[model samples]
Target: MPAQSANSTSPAADRPPAARDTDALLRAELGTAIRKLRKERGLTLVQLAERAALSHPFLSQLERGLTRPSMPSLHRIARALGTTQQVLMAAAAVPHPDIPVGSAHLVRSGEGLPVARPGGTARMLGAPAYSVHPVEYTGMSEEFQDYYDHPGDEFVYVMTGEVEIELQAAEGPRVHVLGPGDSICYPGGTPHRWRAVGDGSLVRLLTVQNATGEADRHHS
Candidate 1:
């Protein structure tokens, strides 16, 4: 066959008009989904823009489907919304491969969790309640305490070494010493401080409170 010209139409050009319409619909749906999620979170456009490190005008345009955001921008927005890019992309009607039973990707805490505090490594194994996090506490030269109050609760199970947990209570500070195989449950709203005892690193598996409740149901 003779060489085809660069401007020649390919087989893709023969696709039905519905296919093109579907793509446009997906793009619009993705934008609308993100905007709805932001509104549900009670975050203003400016607040979300600041969190995503995007300009207000650009974010507004994105929410309106007036502009297509780059992958990085999408990633930032997903992070701000406490979700993954895969979820956001799916909202756009993009099909993703199903995760194999034994091949689920491991998300590193150092990469995903935005630790506002210093010291120790906190990794999230799943979506808060459905996950476990391995927190490794090294030498405590600096007092690391960051006040974070979220909606849910957690149970800390000490795997190795000793951990001192100080909960801020109405009466006074409540201190608890936990060792290997020992776990403690406390309200997530309570401000707390953690320190590794001795010079060794202390490892703990922090289970989500909701999961703990489910486990309790099975045992009870």
Candidate 2:
């Protein structure tokens, strides 16, 4: 064997920086997190760009913190990285508080006005990759409509009551009736409609899309 190196035997030689500027440290940490997640998922920059429907140049800038991503853009990147917006946001340093009831951001449909659809509510929780929210419908007569489309896909899981979903496809329409504990997924490009069923409130947990795309309108 060759002679042992002095630096190789030193533990401090391989240690990370103990103190850094807050802003610079945050940027470095965010960059490292993104790079780590990307590598762990075996995706190259080009592949992640394709998945997020974003230009490779923009993503490169984001990776270097030369460009700051908006919430939607961050969500897209997280999805492409096989993570959640909530996780990415947290890694970027958003603060959260704990209370006696639980975390303050726990969302329940009907507690807040609907952001995308009417008659129902959606709460967004966590970073993009690890975020979750609960949706609640007040009554069966309530029919919710929201227009959305993205580069990735979505899964809707019904937790209570029932829902009638109609997905608008290039060829035509596909209808699905979902009950408690039932779930379904479709391409992000498919425009869709949702309506509550039966005589009680409907509840669902939706895994929202995290890609870039224009919303499509469906009339029926």
Candidate 3:
């Protein structure tokens, strides 16, 4: 069978009216967030689609609030936008506020924007538009995971418990173990992964990632 357009929404047909409305609202909000990020980075619809390896028409539909992207597609778009999927998801939770330079957005205790992570709890600690995005993590993956690479630098500081961080170096893969008060910083585009050191224990980390690099803008 031929592939359906990404804008197709037959699955929502069987849902109750209220549920469909909620879904539509979410799609619209997410679409707006995507569009804003794309424009802020001076990218066109076709440019973003090419970077994300998606169809131009589909991306147009997504930005127009006519469709929602799947998780994989969303991840691709997030990477192409020089940001993380978690940031995009959290930003969509509320209207994007316009704050002047030197202004601040306050998030009270336990009110940080939630970010989904397997076997861990993550939340965005800074506003989406901030030059440096900060996310707090309270747990670790049950097992080692694939290396993750993105557009900007990432600095991780372990606040409690033991943590293991692996970085892919030109020589080979290098692993570092850290306890409280230890930190590591690496440039963007470096492949890296991390996990808690011990069995079923609490580990806390604060990660701050910078804005996209010049190379990412021209090539990705």
Number of the top candidate by lDDT? 3
- Highest-TM-score candidate: 3
Structure candidate 3, residue pairs in collision: none
Q: lDDT tens digits, residues 1-220, model 1?
A: 2211111111233646865454355557567878977886789988888887777777776677555554446656766776543345434532223554444434433322221123343332343212332333323313435433333366777777776788888999888888789988877457776776664344444544332333212211
- Model 2 segments more than 4 A misplaced: 1-94, 98-116, 128-141, 144-147, 211-220
CA lDDT, candidate 2, residue 129: 26
**Candidate 2: tens digits of C-alpha lDDT, residues 73-159:** 555676676554434533544223333333344332222222222444333333322333223333343454453444446677777
Candidate 1: lDDT of 214? 30
* Whole-model lDDT per candidate: 0.52, 0.51, 0.69
**TM-score to true structure, per model:** 0.44, 0.42, 0.63
Tell me the lDDT of model 1 at 83: 57
lDDT of 1: 0.52
Worst ten in a row by lDDT for model 1: 2-11
